[model samples]
Each structure stands twice: as structure tokens, then as C-alpha cells.
Target chain A: MEFDLIERIRRHTEVNRDDVVEGIGDDAAIVAVPSGRELAIAVDTLVEGVHFPAGTAPADIGWKALAVNLSDLAAMGATPAWALLALTTPDGDEAFFDGLARGFAELATPYRLALVGGDTTRGPLTVTVAVHGFTAPGEALLRSGARVGDVVMVTGTLGDAAAGLRCLAEPDASAYAALVERLNRPTPRVSAGQALRGIATACIDVSDGLVADLGHICAASGVGADIDAEMLPRSSALLTHFADADALDFALAGGDDYELCFTVPADRAGEVGATLARLGCGAARVGRIVEDAGVRVFDARGNLYEPARAGWNHFAA
Target chain B: MEFDLIERIRRHTEVNRDDVVEGIGDDAAIVAVPSGRELAIAVDTLVEGVHFPAGTAPADIGWKALAVNLSDLAAMGATPAWALLALTTPDGDEAFFDGLARGFAELATPYRLALVGGDTTRGPLTVTVAVHGFTAPGEALLRSGARVGDVVMVTGTLGDAAAGLRCLAEPDASAYAALVERLNRPTPRVSAGQALRGIATACIDVSDGLVADLGHICAASGVGADIDAEMLPRSSALLTHFADADALDFALAGGDDYELCFTVPADRAGEVGATLARLGCGAARVGRIVEDAGVRVFDARGNLYEPARAGWNHFAA
Candidate 1:
């Protein structure tokens, strides 16, 4: 029965790539990694209620599952090439698979990434995707490479997905369609990340809140960071839907926006912004790396800012 | 809290290799795929109560999770190198992580497979492992390579794990220690697979019983097979614990045994058996590929044989 479902997935996701020697049907997949390139690999799991709210559409779940993993590759400045998806479903309804496969293929086609191999099992609705990409040796952006003098930057606007999640429960959700779509279908900054390969000193994707993820870079690089709250870029939709302080809270401490948070040398910050601008994704110069050892946020009045929640922690009560 | 758990996992699974540019704690792992070698990748998921029964030991779950993935590598005739693990749990218990890590490291240390990167989430207990291995170009043992007039063979003995599952609930479970261990910690035939790369026509690991797994090779190769039921290999432990008919049922249709079902040219069947004998995992010649399109079985008196069940399907009602 699962074999038939796999056949439908294959039909929707079929791609002929020269690098793939063998795919889906074999004991394992065989692929020739591009010569002289280091492979960037990442895996992430999304549970039904934890990663996405229950009753969410299966297509959205499929998109977000692959998006989150691709975001990790983007954070490493790699180009995605292959992915393996392990999906656990509670029922065998083919409509669910059709929607899920269509959603996965929709994102996969633009990147030309092949769904190489994976297994389906009977369990809670969980999706785990392992992605493989290639980066030139010594060119992958690392979390530990940021220096004290570097400038902090981020690709695309923040707080949109966080705001999108909140909009789902609103009585007038149709008015916030864009925000809900942001939460459902995040645009992984794939091309923008590859553009920053040689220029960015340190990089990470914002799955956790901005303050928490930036704190990771600080801890890894033995440095610190200071972000000006007023400098954070906000989407027009976010600004129109919420008050300034609320938007700032979502941007600073809310999670699930798959945006790239990176740093470049202080002098090259302008060049990095220009490069991303032409790519049309755009980036904002939000903060600066400091000599201290933690992430510090300040408001327009120059007072230390505080958020209602620090960050997303899976095991936190 | 999850990061702390990941930190503990990192400490238990830390291994340094030149090919690994970065390990755990990165947004994504950076590993240099060996030059001139193709990569063999596979991912499998095991859900609590579905894959393994409830109340199984945490250590056993960890061991089986990695072991099953390694078995897939062994089937592809690849040398294991790196793995990514995504684990979901209902609670955060230090003892559970300790036992699980120890069991994983006990098997991983020998292969030197570096745990590169993965994520932890809160959900029902599910463990998904994606393993990467290396094989020389054009040397992987594929399912479509078997031909008519080839000898069908299997490594080690069959029926042990199937019988072991039954033994777990028996009052004399301790008397069947070897059988239960086979179910819990089946050895992955890594070295044996590599040794058969240039020799075996086709290969697959028997996670889904001998007849079912061999059926995959036949389907892919466009051939049929005829198995002599009397010639199927049986372990002393399996034979002692059950009558002949029961043992035969387990050998033909029961699942979970991590044995290798392979095909070789009929002319070299004896030589292949001798080779595996030297590897301390003896091979039994029990069947042959034929011109028809589905598997057939013959009893001692030459009558067609039937088993109580067919192969396993994850979504079978």
C-alpha cells in the first residue's frame, strides 16, 4: 500500500539529473558530489502540532518541512541539490500525499533539487527532511568566523511569519492573508545565501528568535552584538497590521521566519547590501559585532530592550 | 533545554576526521566527500509502537536505529562514513539520552562515522537516521543487475529475529537470549558487502524477510526466482526453539532479520559461498533466478509451497 503512495510521489517529483546515478527504488541512493566541493548537509523534523499548528494544510506542512532544512543550507552558503524526506502519517489517504507531494515539488522544481530517497512509516504526522548541497572548500559561511569589528545584517524583512501565525486566530484572517502565507510558505534565501559565500563572515538562519540566534553566533565566535530596534526592517503589511512596539516584539523575539542573519566586515557591509539588493531579496544593516560576550538590544530611546519571550525552545515548559 | 541535550549528544559522538570540516552544533554540517568516489545515501524512520513494541529499552532503540541505516549502506556495497540523526521524544530525561548515546556510540565508534548534524524536537518517540557512505564509481551493487540463471544466496541465518520477537513474550525468554539479541542488535554486514562489490550480481539486506526482499531484486531485474524450502539456512537457536514448520514460516515470511540476500553467477556460486565463509558469515545457496516474473517456492516433495503471510508493508491494513 505504501509502495503505491511512493509511486505517486515519484510521478510528481520525477527529475532527470546527471549527478544522480540511482534514485528512489534502490537500497540506497547513489549520487556523485561535484568535484572539489565540500558537501553541506542538514536535517530537520517538523511535528504536527509543535512545528506547525494542528489542522494546518498538508501542502503547507510539506513546503515548510523542506523550507526549514533549505534554510539551514542557505545559512551555510550552499546550493541545494538533493533531499530525502521521511514522512510519518496517521492515515493512508492518497489526497494527503497528493497535496504533500505537489507542495514539495513546487518548491523543489525552482531549485532543481531532486528528492533522492526516503521512507514512509506509520506514526504521528512528522516530517523529517535531510538536504545535501555543495559549497566550495573553505567558502562555507561559519558561525564562528565573525570578528568583533564585523557588521550584523539580515536578508529580507523579519517578524512576518511570527505575525502570520498570530493572524491565523484573528476574526478577520482574510485581511492578513499575506502574513498567514508567510508563515505557511517561507521563501528560503537560497540564492541570496550563495551570493554571500565569499563576503559574509558569519551566517545563520533565524529559526529561533533574532536575539537567541544572534546569541549563538556571539557564543561561537567569542564576541558580542548590539542591535538597534528602530533599524529592523518591517514589511508594510506587518506595520499596517500592528502597532510599532508589537511589530518590534515579533521581529526581535518571535521565531519561525526563515531569514538569513549574517555578518560582514564593517567596510564590506555596503557592498553586501548592494549585492543582495540586485538579487532583489534586499538586506538590512541591523547591528554591529562588539567586544562583549552576549547579544544586546536597544530601543530608539537608547534603553535596553526586553521582549515578552526570549526564544523558541522545544523542551522548555 | 534542547540545545543542552544536543550538547550531551555532541560530547558522546565527537569524532575528528580530515574529511569533516565541521560537526554538530553548526547550522549545517560541512563534510568533504572523498574525491573520485560516489556517495550512497539512505534514510529510515522507526516509530515507537509501530516499528518496535512499546516498553523497549532506550539503548536498544538507539542501537537498532543506527543499525538499520548501516544495513542499507551494507546493501549498497558502500563504506559508511557520516550520519545525521533526528530524534523526537515525549520527555527530556538525562538517563534516556545517556543510554541512547552510549548504544549509538558503541556501534558508531568502529565505523568512525561522524555524527554531523541533526535536530531534536518534542513529539511522539521517533528516530530518523540518514546515513552517507562512499563507493567507487560503477561499483555499487544495484537491484537491477541480477540476471537469469544466477544463484540466489543469503548471508548468515534467517528466522532468528522473527523467532526472537516471539521469544520476547515467552515465559522462558531468558532461555532465548541469543534470539532476542538478534532482534535487538543485529549486526550490519558492512565488510561482507564491500567484499562482494565486484563479485555479486545484485544485493539487498533482508529487513523484510528472505522471500520479500529477494522479490525486490527479482522485480527490479525482471526475473523470477525458485527457492527450495528445505535448503533455507536455519540457526541452532531457531531450530531448537520451534518445530520445523514454524521455523520455516519465520525463515520465509517473518521480518526484521538484517541478513543479506544476494545473487551471483551460477558458475561461481560455490566460490561465493566459500568467500563468505572466510568472513565468518556463511552464505547458503537456496534458490536460483528463473525466466518467470514472480517468486515460487518448492517443498521437499516438489510440491508448490505456501506461507501463512507475505512480505511486510508499512501501510497494510
Candidate 2:
């Protein structure tokens, strides 16, 4: 029965690529990478009650699964190529599989990412996606290259996904359709990441909120950052639904925002911003890299700011 | 807490290599694939009650997860290189993580496989591993290359894992230590697969029963196979633990063998067998590819044989 459901998924999400010598229906997938190109690989898993609410749609779960992995590839400035999915559901839920395949295809088709191979098994609702992308040797972005006096920037708006989740839990909070959409389906900044390939000193995706992910950059690059909290980009939808303090808090520490947060040399900040603007991403220079060794946030008055929670920690909960 | 567990895993299983531009602690891992080599990728998932018994040790679970994925790579005649693990536990179980990491390192160290990038989530007990290997371009052994008159073969003894599983269920069933070990830690036939690279026409790993997996080769290659039940190799451990009929049934239809089922041309069967023998894994000639398009088994009396179950079906249970 699981095999039959896998066949259903295979039919809905097949890609024909010359380089993919073998796609599905094999013990393993065989793909030819162009000469001199390095492979960038990432994997992410989403659980039912942990990553999403229990009543979330199957299609939304599928989209979020691939979206999170693609965000990782984007953070590395790699071109998406292939993906493998390991899906577990209660028994063989054919309807759920169909909906999930459609959702996966919705995100995968635009990137030209092929679903090469994977496994389907019986268990709690979970989706694990492993994405493979290509980058020119020595060109992929890393979190360990941030230098002192660099400018910190972020693409898209923050706190929308977290706000969306709040709205999902409390429908009376606000009925902002756009925020809900952002929560259900994130737009991975693939093109913007490619645009910043040579410009950004270090990069990471804002998965565990802006502050925590940026802290990763500081730790890896042996540098620190000071963020101007007032400079954080906020969408009109977020402002309409949330008050200033709540929205700022969510933007600072709430997780599940699949936006790219990166650092660029102070001299190249304009070029990076202009490039992202041309791509229609419109990044914001929210902070600056410092010589200190941890992330610090300051309000508009230059006073240190703290939040109730830094970000989502799986075990801390 | 998840991050701390990941740190422990990183410390326990770190592979330092010049080719690995980046390893763990990154959003994605960057590895240089040598020029002129194609990558072979495969993924497998194991669930608590579905894939194994509930009380199985954490170390064994980790070993089996990586071993199954390596088996897929072995079936393609690919040399193991890197792997990504997505582990979901009910909570951040530190002891379980340590035991699992140790078990994973045991199998990974021999192949020099690096633990690259992955995600740790909070959910039911699940382990999903995606492995990446390298093979010479156009040299991967696929399941769609078997030809008529080719000799069907398998590496290692059959029925040991199945018989061992029985022993696990009923501890009173003949105390065969080897059988229990085979069920808990099935060795992946990587060396034998490499040895059969040019000699075998087609290949697949026996994760499902021999009949089911061989049937896959037949369906892919548009051919049939006829196996002689008497020719099936039975380990002394399996034979001592099970009666003749039960042992034969287990060999034919019981799963989890992790042996390579392949086909070599009739003229080169002797050469292929000699190569595997040199690799310390003897080959068994239990069947032959035919012009028909389904797998059939014949008993010693020359009559057709059928078992109660062809193999495990995840959803059927």
C-alpha cells in the first residue's frame, strides 16, 4: 500500500532532465554534476505539532517542508537542483499524499528542482526534505566570513510568519490573509542570494528568528553585531495587525521567518542593496558588524533592548 | 537543547577532510565532487514501531538507519562519501543521542563517510538518513540492465536476518547469537558491490525479500527469473534456529537481508563469483534470467512454490 502511494506521488512529481540519468524507480538516484562545481547539500525535518499546528493542511505542510530546505540552499547562495523527500504519515493516507505532492510540486516546479528519490513509511505525520544544489568552487556563501565593520542586511520583512501563526491560533486576533499566506508558504530568496554571492561577507537564513540566526554568524565568524531594532523592515500587513511593541518583539525573536540575513563589507553595502533592489527584494540595512562577540540590540534611543524569548528552541520547550 | 545535542553528535562523529569545505554547524554542507564523477544519492527512513520493535536499543537504531541507506548506495556500486541525518525524538534525549551517534560512527568510520548537515526535531522517534556517494560517470549498476541468459546471484547468506528477527520476537527460539546479530546489525555488502561493478549486468539490494527485490529487476529489465529453491544459501545459524520449511520460507520472502541481488552474463558468472570470493563474500547462483516477465520459484520436486508473504508492506500492518 505504501508502494502504491509512492507511485501516486511519483506520477505527480516527476521531472525530465538530461543530467538526471536516473530519477525515481531506482535504488538510488544518479545525477551528473558539471565539472568543477561543488555540491551544496541540506536537510530539514518538520513535525506535526512542533513545526506546524495539528490541523494544518497537508498541502501547506508539504510546501513548508521543501520551502525550509530551499531556504537553506538560498542561504548558501547555491542554485537549487534536486531534492529527496522522506515522508511519514499514519498508515497510507492516499488523500494526504496527493495533497502533499501537489504542494511540493507547487514550490519545486518554479525552481526546476527535481524530486529525484526518497522513501515513504508509516509513522506520525512528518516530512523530511534533503536538497542538493550547485555552486562554483569557492563561491558559495559561508557564515564564517563576516569581518568587523561590515554592514548587516536582511531581505523581505520579518515577524510576518510568526504573526501569521499567532493569527492561526487565535482567529479573533486579526484576519490578515497575506500574513497567513506568508506563514503557510515562504518565498525563499534564491535570486537575491545569487545576487549577493560576491557581495555578502557572510550569510544565513532567518529560520530561528533574526537575532538567533545572526548570532550564529557572529559565533562562526568570530565577530559581533549591533542591530538598530527600529530599522527592522515591517510589512503593512504586520503593522495593521500588530501593535508596535508586539510586532517588534516578534520581529526580533519569534522564529519561522525564511528570510535571508547577511553581512556585507561597509564599502559594498550600497552595491548589495542596489542589486537586491533590482531583483525587487529590497533589503534593509538593519545593523552593523562589530568586534564584540555576541548579538546586541538597541532601541532608537540607543538603549539596550531585551526580549522575553530569543527564538524557538526545540528542547527548551 | 537540540543545538547542544547536535554539538555532541558533531564532536562524536567529525571527519576532517580537505575536500570538505564546510561540514556540520552550517546551514548546508559544501563538498567538492571530483571532476568527471557523478553523484549517487539515496535516502531511507526508520520509525519506532514500524521499522523496528519498540524496545530496540538506540545504538542499533542508528546503525540500521545508516546501514540501510549505505545498502542503497552499494546496490548502485557507488563509493560512500557523505551523509545527512534527520533525527526526531519525543524530546531531546541526550543519552539516546550519544548512543545513536556512537552507533552511526561505528559504520561510518570504516568507509570514511562524513557526517555533513542535518536537522534535529521534536517528534516521534524517527531517523531519516540521506547518503551521497560518488561513482564514475555512466558506470552505476542499475536494475534495468539484466538480460536474458544472465545468471542471477546474491552475496552473503540469506534468511539469517529474518530468522534473527524471529529470535528477537521469541527469545526462547534457539539461542543463536549470530542470527540475532544479523537481525540487529546487518552488514552492507559494499565491497562485494564494488567487486561486481563491471561484471554484473544489473543489481539491487535485498531490503525487501529476495523474490520481491528480484522481481523489481525483472520488471525493470523486461525479463523473468526462475529460481531453484534448493540452491538458496542458508546460514548455519539460520538452519539451526529454524526448521527446513520455515528456513526456506524466510530465505525466499522474509526481508531485511541487506544482501546485493545482481545478475551477471552466463559466460562471466565464474569470473564474478571469483571476484566476490576474493572480497571475502561468497556469491550464490540461485536463479537465472529468462525471457518471460515475472519471478517464479521451483521447489526441489520441480513444482512451483509460493510463500505466505512475499515481503513486508509498511501500510499492510
Candidate 3:
């Protein structure tokens, strides 16, 4: 019975072309693009009740499913080229798949990424996007290049998503309305990531909080960090919603920020700052990579400060 | 809650320098390899109850999970290079992920594939693998090249998985032990797929039964098929466990066969047979691609036969 539905859905989508060396019927899809470019590949999965709240908008879910994957390519400073979507639907719903594809097509067109191939199977509502990009060899930005004394900067404001989540927990929370939008539709710092190809020493996104994600860089580059709480940016809405210290906590340790956190050497920091300023983006000297072993927090007067939990973890309470 | 476990598990695995330019600490892992080769990317998802039966052996589940994706690369005639795993597990029991990774690493080593990157989250039990392979440009086989009048060939015996599934439904039965293993641990026809890179016209794996998956090729290549039931090669275990007609039905449309089914030009059929023989594999011309509009199955005396249903569907009666 379910097989019949897949047959019908398979018929609606036609895979035919010379360049598509192989299509849906094979174990994997194959395509031939121009040679000589390095292939940039990234994979991301969205699990039900984890990535999104229960009963979230399916259309938004579809949009976000691909958007998050595209975000990874953006962080890597790669132009999106092609994508393979693996969708696991609870049950067979042609309408759901069509709706999901519509959401994907909406972004794929503007980004110039084609839906090359993928698979559909019975499972929980899980969507895995494996994206392929083409760039000149040795051009991708990585997270292993930060050095001591480098200035750490971020792309966007923090704690909006965390605040938005708070709003969801309690309805009619007019204080953080703007933060809700930030949480729902995060604009990936695609341009900024691409622009920092050679300038930034190391780069990572603030999906898992400013402090925790920075810890990733610290661990990888074998360095420590000294973050200034005073220099951290904040929104008026967030500040109004939470106490000064609480807002700072959210800014420092909130996950799902989806903003770019990067390290730039002091010598090249001015050039990067000026270039980013030209694009109407702002960066703060939030911290400096230290030769020490652990992350340290400092107040406006350079006094030591400590965070409650340091950050959020997906599996931890 | 789930994040700490992820951090702990991530620590146990060391990312080698050559395969991973930047390891697990970034937004998206960066991998640098040589150029001029096309990347073969395939994503597969295994749900809790849909893809695997309840209470499946954890090690076998892990092995089968990666095996299916590897099969996809095999179908495309690409050499496996790297894989990204997105795992969602219910809280507690560290052995679950550790065992899964152990199974994945064991198979990955022999194939020269490395676990490059992925995401770990807390949710329902789900494993989605995005496998990346590399092949010379224009070398991957596709399923849209089957010309009318091409001879339809299958690489190995069929219906073992379907038979194995039957044994699983009655686990107490002792007659078909090998069939159960065949169903659980399917060997993806890697060598045959690689060698047939330039030989076969259009190809696909027999996952959704022979008739249904073949229907995809027929629809894609703008051709139809006339398969002869008598020519289908089946294991002795399948024949012994089921009645003759039932065995034929399973052979005609059994999902999870994982064997390569493809079409070759009539003149090239001899070459395909010889190539498979040289590779120590079996290949039999089972039928011919027809000019008709749909798949038609016939017995030895040319009597048309219809299957009970096409194949498995996620959503169906």
C-alpha cells in the first residue's frame, strides 16, 4: 500500500538529463560537473522534538531543514551548488513532501543550488541535508588557525533565540518580540564568512552558545580565552526582558544564536573590522586568545567573573 | 542532558590529520583532498521501527545502517571516502552510541573511509548517514541510460532478504538460518558495481522489489520492461522455505534484495556476463527492456502474471 504511494510520488518527479549520469533508480545519484574545483560537502540533520519544538509549522520546519544545511556551507565560505535531501516521514504523505520540496525550492533557486538527488524512507520526522559546493582548492576557512593574542569577534547579537524561546514558554511576552523573529529566521552570515576567507585565523558558528562554541576553538587551537563581559553586545529588548546579569548570562551562554564567532590576529583585525564595517556589520573585541588553559571571564573593571553553567548542551540538563 | 554525552563520546575518537583538515569542533568539518575527482554523496536514514525491526541486535543494526549507504556508493560505482553520522538517542545507556560507532568504525577501516563529521542530538533513536565517495569524472553509473531493447540483468540471486524477513517474523523457525543472515547483513555488490562502471547502460539496486525498482528505471529511461520469471536466480534456502509460486512472487518483488539490477545493450550483454564472471560474480540476462509503456512479467510459456502489490511504502494500507 505504501509502495503504491511512493510509485506515484516518484512518477511526479522526473529525473532525466545527460548531465545526471544516474538518477533515482540507483543506490546513489550521480552527476557530472565541471572538473578542477574542490568539492565542499556538509551534512546536517533535524530531529523531531529536539531541533524544533513539537507541533512547529511544517513549512517552517521544511525551510529550516535546508536553511541550516545552507548555513554550514555559508560558514565554510562556500557557494552552495547541489544538495541531496534524505527525508524520513512518519507516514506517507505526498502533500507533506510536496510542501517540503516547495520550501526547499524557494531557497535553492536564489542560492543557485540544485536538488540533485536524495532518498525517502519511513521513519521519524528527520531531514538530513548533504550539500555539495565547488570552490578553488585550499580556500575553505577552518577552525584550527587561531593563535594566542588574537581578538575574538562575533557576527550578530546574541541571546535572541534564547529570549524567543522564553517568550514561547510564556505567551504575550511583548518584551522580546524582536528576539522571536531572530530565533525563527536566523540570517546566516554567508557574506561575512565568505569575506573572511584569508583574514580570520579561525571560525565557528555560535549555535551552541558564545562561550561553549568558543571553547571548541580554544580546544582545537590549543589556546585559552579571556572574554570581557562588558564588550559583549546586547539588544535593548533582551536587556529590558532580563536583569543586567541575566541578560549577560544569556548573551554569553545561550545556544542557538547561529551567529559567527571568529578569531582574527591583532595585525589583521583592523582590516577585517574595516571591511566588515563597510558591509554594515559590527564586530567587538569580545575576548582575546590567551596562552592559558581555560576560558576566563572579566568584568568592566577587569575583575574576575564566573558564569552559572558556562553553556547549554544538547544531551545535558 | 544529551550534549555532555556527545562531548564525552566525541573525545574517544581521534580524527586523523590526512582525512580531516579540521575535526569535530567546528560548525561544519573541513576536509581537504585531491582535486579532479567527482564526489559521490548519499544520505540514508534508519528509523526506530520502520527500517529495523524492534529489538534488533545493536551491532547488526549499526553494521546494516552503514552498509546500506555504502551500497548506494557501490551502486553509483564510487569509492567510499568519508561519512558523516547524525545520531539521535534516548537518554542514558552510553553503550548504545559506543556500540554503533564501533560497528561503523570497523567497516569504515577496511573500505578506507573515515568518519569525517556529524551532529549528535537527543531525540528518538535515529541514525542518518551522509556518505561521500570519489570517482573519476563521468565514471559513475546511472539508471536513466537504459535504452529500449537492452537486456535486463541482475548481479546475484534474489529474494533472500524477503525470505529472511519471513524467518524473522517466525524467529522460532529453524529451517532458514542463512536466509535470516542474508536479510540482516546484506553485502552490497561493490565489485560488480565498480567493474560495470562503463559497461552497464542503466542501473539500480533491488531495494524496492525487482518490479518496482525496475519501474523507476523504465519510467526514467522512457522505456518499459518484460521480465521472465523463470530466469530469476534464487537461493536454495528461499526455494526450500516457501512454495514455488510464493518464492517466485518474492523473487519478483522482494524489497531489501540490495543486488544490482541493470540494463545493457543487447550486443553488450555478452561483455557484461564475461565481466561479471571475471569478477567472480554472477550475472544473468533475465529479460529485455520493452517499447511498451509499463513493466510486464511473464512466465516461461509467456503467460502474464501480476504481483500482489508493488513493494513497501512508508504510508499505505
Candidate 4:
């Protein structure tokens, strides 16, 4: 059964270049480490109950497993090259596992990310993907690079994913299909991240709501933030679906937005904005770093609204 | 509860200056890419019903998950540096999860490995560990580098894990206590693996029994092996507990032996053996690589013993 599933996944992807040495179907993968590149490795595990709603589509689940790990690499301004999947599923259907693997392979192929190794086991539905990427030695954009007075920016919009989740929880409500798709299939900003390689002072992906994830960057970089709420990028699609009370709250604290949030020096902000525009992604000058170590959000009237205590905490109720 | 567990594990070992930039408690681990080093990464997942018997202790499961992934990194002759753990368990007992994490953290600390980052979820008992190690650039040992005339050697004893499993399968039986320990905590050859840095030609860790794992090395290196039954590493503890037929068969095909099986030039055998001994490890020459494509084992009377057709296929019954 595993063999049959493996065969199905193998058919969809093109194996280019011999540098992979060995791809899949081995005890472990063997890849040629090109000389003079720093390897960036990260692993992410998404279980059925914690990372997504139970009984989510296997295809979406597979796509998300790879997407979240790729998001980590993207935060480092690294170009992803290969991945290893350790997938655990209930041992019932060979075709189901095949579908999941095929979905993963389909997304990976276009990105030139080779599925070099994986392990399949029988258990509850869980997917752990380890990604390998490369960057010029010592050139990764870290969360510690942000400085006081650096202008904080975010690529693309936020709050869409959190709103999508709310829609999923209450599916009877009418909403735009694109918002729901954003919740299910987030596009990792790989190219935009690579473009920010030398320019961005600090970077991170907005996984746990914008406010929460940016707090990580601020804490690591030892800086504070004053976000101008009115300047946040809002999609007509998101505002239309959640234009009601506290819709802005979803944008502020909604997790699962796989967009890149980074900091740029004031002098480099224009160039970075132009670069992102050329890449067809919208950029928002949402905030600026401060010498203090607290994050504050201000409305156009300069009044601060109380932030919600809920962000996505897996272990908490 | 997670905080308490992390503190307990953190107290067991100290971090070294060479292996970490930031350890634990971060968005992701920030590791320094050492000059002239290439990173080797591997991930493995263990599910309750799939990888072990039902009702296995969480502590043992924790040990095995990290051990198996460490075994993979050892195969590359890479020095262990950091690990990320993804654990899914029923949320009823926070203590259970904490115990499991403590066991993993304690085991990892002695190897100079830090718990970098991980995700936890509520689900069936599943543990996935992603290990990251570093070796001098272009110096990692590969399974595909074995030569036809090289001597195949295994560090420490084989089949201890399988023997331990037999005891676990029938706990009331009169098996020795040492065999059970072997099954529960199969120590990976970390030191021997590091020592083989410049000596061994090709290496792989024995996880899925000797025959099945050596088959992997053989397929990768485009060579075969001729193993001698008389020279096989057999535990007297196993002999005392099993019928001759079962013991020998289990010794031949039992899985989960976390020992290093590597090939070295015949002329380097003495040096490799002496080197392992200096590190307090047992290095036994058990076979020779052959030009043929399949593994062949000879019994004590010089009669050839072919492995069973169905050898340790996890997907197959």
C-alpha cells in the first residue's frame, strides 16, 4: 500500500539535476551540499487538533504542512531547496495517503523544492516537515537585526487567515471564497523574502497573529513598536466579509497570516517598498521601532484600543 | 507544566560555546553556521501503534524517538548539535507530556544538543524528532561511498533491541533485565560516529534490523554484503531467553538496533577497531562488501541462509 502511494506521488514531480544524489525511497536522504552556502534547516509539525480543524481536507493539510515550514525559511530570507516529510496517518486507505503526498509534491515541484526523503507511519493524522534551504554564508536576516527607529513593514495583507478561520467555525455565514482560501492555502512569500536578503534589518512570518509575531521580532531585536492602525493594509475582500464590529481586531490579532513582516531602515524604506511593488506584493508602513520595549497601537485619532488577549496559544485553553 | 519540564531538562546539562547561538525559548533556534561546516538534518516519527507495541511508556517512546533520529545523523558522521521535537498526545495528562519532554531533553543535553524549537498538539501519542548536526564541509560520510572490497563492521552488539522487544512482548517471561533495557533505551553511537569522521568509507545506522538496514547501504552504494553468521554479535542474554530457532532468526531480522553499521577499507579495519575501542565501543568485523547486488549470509556450517522474503515492511503486515 505504501509502495502504491509512493508510486502515485512519484509520477507528478519532475526530478531535475543530479545534485540530489538520492531522492526519496531511502533510509535517509543523501544530497550534495554545495560548497560555500550556509544551510538553513527548520522543522514544523502540524497535528490534526492543534494546527487545523479536525477532518480538514487531506490535500489542504498536506499543503499546509509544507507551507508552514517554508514560511520559516522565508523568514530567514533563504531559498528553499529540499524537504523531508515524516507523515503519520491512520492506517486505513492507501489512496488517501497518496492524495496527501501528491498534493504536497504538486506544490513543491513549482518551487524547485525536491522531496528528498520522508517516513510514513501509522497513527493519528500528523505531518512533520523538515526543510533545507541555503543562503550566502552569514547573510540570513534574523529577528535580532531590528534597531530603534527602523520602520516596520509587512508584505501583503493580514487578518485574512484569522477571519477565514472564523468563517470555517461558522460556515453558514456568507463570506468571500477568497478569504476562506487564504485560510486554507497561504502563499509563502519566498521570492519577496529572497529579495529582502541584504536589505531588511529583521524579518519574521505572521503565523501567530500580526501583533503576537511582531512582538517576537521586537523582543528579539530589543526594540518597541508603535503601529499606526490606519496604515495597515486591508483587502476589500477582508473588510467586506468582516466590516462589522472589531473586524479590525481580527486583522490585528488574527494568526495564520503567512505574510512576511520585516523592518527596514528609514533610508531604505522607499527602495524596499519599490522592490516589493515590483514583485506584485503590497507593502504597508504599519509601524516604527522605538527605544522602549512595549508594543502600542494607535487609531487615527491617537487613542489606543485595548488589544485582545487571545492570539493563538496551542497549549492554553 | 512545559516550563517545569524545560527547567528540569535544562538543569541536566550545560550548553557549549561552539554549538549554539540561542537555545530554547524563541520563535526558532538561532544557530551560528560554523565556518567550513555543512549541516546534516534528519527527521523521524514514532507513533504508538505503529512504531511500538500498544501501551508503551511515554518515557521509552521519548527516548526511542530521539535515538532513531540521532542514529540517522550519526550515519553521516556529523556531530550532534541541536534537535526539535514535535509531540502529539491526549491533553488529559499534562504530566505525561512533561515527562516525555523531560526524557528527551535530558538525553539530548549530554550530546551537546539543545532543544531548539518544536510544536506540540493534542492527538494520539506521536513523537517526531528532527535532528541537526554539523560536519566539516564536504566531509560527511554517505552510504553510497562503500567500495566492493571494503570490510563491513558494526559497532557494539546487534539485535539487542529486537531481543528487548521479545521480552516486552512477553513481559512475564524469564528474559534478562539487561535485554529489556536494551530495547527501551538503545544508545546511539554518537562518540564512535564522531570518531569515524575521517576513517570510515561509508556508514548507516541499523534501525530496521541488520539485514534490512544493510540492504539500504547496499542499494545506495551499488554493492552487496556477505555476512557470516558465526561472527554475528549475539547476546548471551538473548540466547538464554529464546529458543535457538527464534533467537537466531530474530538476531538476523530483528529491527530497531541503533548501532552503526559501516564499511571501511580492509586495510583500515585494525585502525577503525582500535579507534572505536579507545572510545569504549565494540567494533566487530562481521562481513565484507561484495560485487553482487543482494545480501548473502552464511551459517556456522558454511551453509548460506537467505533472508525471508517479507523483511520488516512497515506498511505490510
Worst 10 residues of 3 chain B by lDDT: B6-15
Best by lDDT: 1
Please provide, for model 2 over A101-165, each residue's C-alpha lDDT reduced to its tens digit, 9 standing for 90 to 100: 99988989888899989898888989999999999988899999999999999998999988888
Q: Least lDDT summed over 10 consecutive residues: which range in candidate 2 chain B?
A: B308-317
Separately for all candidates shown, the number of backbone clashes (residues 3 or more apart, or on different chains) is 0, 0, 11, 2
lDDT of 3 by residue, A108-157 (tens): 66666666666677767877787766555677767778899899988768
Ranking of models by lDDT: 1, 2, 4, 3
Specify the highest-TM-score model's number: 1
TM-score of each: 0.98, 0.97, 0.90, 0.85
Q: Kindly report the fnat of each predicted structure, to 2 decimals.
A: 0.97, 0.94, 0.54, 0.31
In candidate 3 chain A, where is summed lDDT lowest over 10 consecutive residues? Answer: A1-10
Docking outcome class, model 1: high
Q: How close is candidate 3 to the true structure, as a TM-score?
A: 0.90
Tell me the DockQ of each model, to 2 decimals.
0.93, 0.90, 0.54, 0.37
lDDT of model 2 at position B224: 100
- lDDT computed for candidate 3: 0.74
Q: TM-score of chain B, per candidate?
A: 0.97, 0.97, 0.91, 0.91
DockQ of model 3 vs. true complex: 0.54
List candidate 1 segments past 4 Å from native: A314-317, B313-317
- What is candidate 3's lDDT per residue for B112-157, written digit by digit as tens? 6766667776667777887877777777877778888899999888
> Relative to the unseen true structure, what is the C-alpha lDDT of residue B226 in candidate 2, on a scale of 0 to 100?
98
In the range A14-44, model 1's lDDT, one tens digit per residue, is 8788999998888899999988888999999
